[model samples]
Target: MTTQNRNVEIEERHVEKKTDSSMVASTFIKYTAYIIIFFGALYFLVRYVFPMF
Candidate 1:
């Protein structure tokens, strides 16, 4: 009985780990767009604004 209970607990932990991985993937996808836009704007500033001096 203890072994069975341990197996169930392990399965629950695996499920929680899967959900945590998905959350990380979702956050990465969400931030990737912002990161791209931020770098793009920075590039534009460097290309256009710095040449004025």
Candidate 2:
């Protein structure tokens, strides 16, 4: 019974790790997307709007 309990605890820890990793990955992706969008907007203004003036 103790061995079974130990196995269950180990499995729970592994699942927790996976959840943490996925959360980290999602946060990274969100930040990356925001940075890309910001840079793209900046590029557009420098390339198009600046020349129009």
Candidate 3:
């Protein structure tokens, strides 16, 4: 019967797990390092480069 076939198909179904790559600790650490480097460069430019003019 169609109902029995459907039951068999449902029973054989697989479930997959999905994970977030961007929200991981390594990603957070990388972005934080980038932000720190950017701010450090900006500070250097303002403190040293701009004063020469």
Off by over 4 Å in 2: 1-19
**Per-residue alpha-carbon lDDT of candidate 1 for residues 11-46, written as tens digits (9 for 90 to 100):** 444444335888888999999999999999999999
Model 3, position 40: C-alpha lDDT score: 100
All candidates: CA RMSD (Å)? 9.0, 10.0, 5.1
- Judge candidate 2 against the unseen true structure and give its global Cα lDDT, from 0 to 1: 0.85
- Please name the candidate that would achieve the greatest lDDT relative to the true structure: 3
C-alpha lDDT values of all predictions: 0.83, 0.85, 0.87
What lDDT tens digits, residue by residue, belong to model 3 across residues 12-34? 76889877876687899999999
The TM-score leader among the candidates is 2
- Using lDDT, rank the candidates from best to worst: 3, 2, 1
- Which regions in candidate 1 have their CA more than 4 angstroms from the true location? 1-23
**How many clashes in candidate 1?**
0
The TM-score between candidate 2 and the true structure equals 0.64
Q: How many backbone collisions does model 2 have?
A: 0
Considering only N, C-alpha and C atoms within 3 Å, which residue pairs clash in candidate 1?
none
lDDT of 3 at 51: 100
Task: Kindly report the root-mean-square deviation of model 1 from the true structure over all alpha carbons.
Answer: 9.0
Tell me how many clashing residue pairs each candidate has.
Answer: 0, 0, 0
Question: How many residue pairs clash in model 3?
Answer: 0
